[model samples]
Target: MQQTKRIAIIAHNNKKNDVLEWAKFNRFFLAQHELYATGTTGKLLEQEIGIPVHKLQSGPLGGDQQIGAKISMQEIDILIFFWDPLEPQPHDPDVKALLRIAVVWNIPIACNRASADFLITSPLMRVEYQPYLPDYQEYLNHNYDQQTTKVRQEQPVSLDTA
Candidate 1:
């Protein structure tokens, strides 16, 4: 409903604290926009930085999938994911998928604190960016609309045999 940019935060185990610290130092800049993040990361950000965040689930347990869906739906404008480069994760598939979606949606992505820092201070973020994005919903809605129409065409049948 709100037209303000939606920024999502997600961090790997090794970088969660780093992300929280970065958020704390940049709280004033981050407070002006809507924020979302994975469950633990969101909770930690709140407890440590005092910034509210809409929480999803843990990334290994479908949190990335949740945010990916939002990105596909054009609901997310920025993605700040602080991932661990030194460690490999079993859920890399989901993490990669989330990042891929961010690229496909043309949303700005920051994978580290430095990038996030630069992003939080950028002037463009405070401005509207809708006009720069291409028309996309028509293609995305094709399957949903077809399924809805098919469902509507089918009449409900009541069981009369007893």
Candidate 2:
């Protein structure tokens, strides 16, 4: 990862203000990085914090999936998502999938203000860091080998009678 990170900030309806407050407090640190957010959150961050953000569709409208795609593509380096656990979300599955993609891609994720603070303040944030990526090719080859063996075993021998 580069010293200047690509950070995605997202917040559920009830947690928007809390995320905004956290963003305002960390404006100095956040300003140096590339910022991205889902619709309303992005607009609010721009209006309240004065930091420019790349806005995507709202979470319910596919923003979480967009962020997940970015993470999978390695375009996003970190995620700060303040999701409301108390309130049920209509798009809960997207939220879970986003978190899963972040982990699968080995990106930094901050689920709340406290964790975001720690993540932003960590010395690692200021340096070029290479995260460990698991080798999926090996896994694919293993699975292919198993499938090929199974297919061969499943095939019945046909004797040709002249």
Candidate 3:
């Protein structure tokens, strides 16, 4: 039996329609997996596609951060984000952060329709494929040790007769 994958879908305002169409085309396949989305996107998918979607806050209202947190926690397996490159976003930093976290966690991310198509059609999507993930704890420990050493090197020695 194939494990049910957790997938996140997000799209910019101008790309919502594109994502909707894509979702409609893949509705049957999508139904087999768990779905999550930002507020408006989730509502539209549930209403138009008749598929249940767990809705997070709107992107500008912290939805991207919420997704990023899920990726870090290893709760999300795939991310389909249809972001508009031509337009500037109010929460651009959040969007970049979310993408960065997804990369860091080794989550499979599809930024456009073509990538999504490739990912969806891959046989690995239905099977359990192990992805390499960086050891965040080890990274944190290394950083802490580096900082401790740096602080020690910067500290000044006290003179006698203090």
Candidate 4:
């Protein structure tokens, strides 16, 4: 079976044109995989490239958080985010969180056209490659244990003197 990658594409308002052009240039390559995008970007790509894109809500309207959730759940294999570094975003925290989750999950991510080109052209793009993912269950368990301990320590001791 051929391995198909689930790719998420996102672009800031200022970089949408750049992402559109890049997507057009790589349409053939991208068509082989599953595509997802934030609202406007998804509509633009679908209309211009004639490719199906799963559209999430607009970034400021929680689209970035949706993508972050997908990353955490391992539903996305790659992320192509053309964020505008020169401009401030109203949803900057969401963007950072999305990027952070991508890193934590050890997924491939491209922040620019150059990196996207490299990622799409790499031999591994056509083959199945396993990335090293840290075991987070241990961390979750540790946190839960610590919380339990803290709650136990904070419980009021019952004083019964009859």
Candidate 5:
């Protein structure tokens, strides 16, 4: 990863204001990086941070999966997701998947304001740091049941919500 990181930020409906406040407080460091966000959060961040943010769909509408895809593709270097743990989300699976993907890709993830603060202020953000990528070739090469493979091939997962 370069000094200018590709940062993906997300906030649950209940935590939107908290995240916005956090973003506003850390505007200086955040502006130096490439920012990405989901739906309303993106719009709010852009207004508050005064920087371009790559906006994806709303979380329940597939934004979480979009962020996961970006992480899998190495497009995102860090994730700042301010999710509400106390609340039950309609798209909880997608949130789990996004978090899983972030871990699978070995990127830094901050789930709360305190962690986000630590991440943004970390010295590593200002330098080029290459994370160790786990090789998944073997996993991909493993043979699956023909029936399952055929079923999966027949029904490809689409990320589009439209």
Candidate 6:
């Protein structure tokens, strides 16, 4: 239900192609949203896919840091980082740390093509945040508390009640 004003995309060495393919597949959804990406990946997407992408430096060359900063500032909504699971990246720690922050922020993220598809295809992707959605987190937390309290109330009143 959110505007999803901005989204950041990143891809490891081996996954750039995969991300590009997915990007092309979602060009319609992407065109309506602002896009951010690392140097090479952004360039490729812009050149081949014709999508305007705000380019950061190469991930290993401080681009990841830039994206992390945006994430912390709540300037980013969705993040898609296609990681190379098999290869060892020198900047692996930075990637992990950035992902940790995304989790903490409760941002919607798509690490692979499948998840990305689901997210982009969701009916709410381009819709404005409904009144109920804006406070969904708080509502969920309160509901959880009520459910726990109800469980306690329904517990045996006494060991010898019968």
Count of backbone clashes, every candidate in sequence? 0, 0, 0, 0, 0, 1
Give the RMSD in angstroms, all C-alphas superposed, for model 5: 8.6
Candidate 5 lDDT, tens digit per residue, 1-162? 998999999999999999999998988888899999999999999998898999999989999999999999999999999999999999999999999999999999999999999998888989999999999877766645566778888996899999
Better of 5 and 6 by lDDT: 5
The TM-score obtained by model 4 is 0.95
Better of 1 and 2 by TM-score: 2
Which residue ranges in model 5 land beyond 4 Å of their true spot? 143-162
Best by the TM-score measure: 4
Alpha-carbon RMSD of each model: 5.9, 2.4, 2.0, 1.5, 8.6, 9.5
Q: How would you encode candidate 6's per-residue C-alpha lDDT over 1-162 as one tens digit per residue?
A: 357568899999899989988988878788889999988999998987787899999999989889988987778887888888899999988898889878766777888899888877877777875422133578789999999999999998887856
Q: Which ten residues in a row have the lowest lDDT in candidate 6?
A: 128-137
lDDT of 3 by residue, 12-116 (tens): 999999999999999999999999999999999998899899999999999999999998888899999999999999999999999999999888899999999
Q: Per-residue lDDT tens digits of candidate 2, residues 1-162? A: 998999999999999999999999988988999999999999999999898999999999999999999998899999999999999999999999999999988898999988999999899999999998767798899999999999999999888776
TM-score of 3: 0.91
Q: lDDT for every model?
A: 0.86, 0.94, 0.94, 0.94, 0.94, 0.84
> Candidate 4, residues 1-162: lDDT per residue as tens digits?
137899999999999999999999999999999999999999999998999999999999999999999988888999999999999999999999999999999998999999999999999889887878779899999999999999999999889866
Best by lDDT: 2
- By TM-score, the candidates rank as 4, 3, 2, 5, 1, 6
Return whichever of 3 and 6 wins on TM-score.
3
Please give, for residues 1-162, the per-residue lDDT of candidate 1 as tens digits: 234678899999999889988988888877878899998998998888776789999898899999999988878888999999899999999988999888877888899988988876777777766535666688769978998989988968768877
| Model 6 score (lDDT) | 0.84
Q: 96 in model 3: Cα distance from truth in Å?
A: 0.6
**Ten contiguous residues with the weakest lDDT in model 3:** 1-10
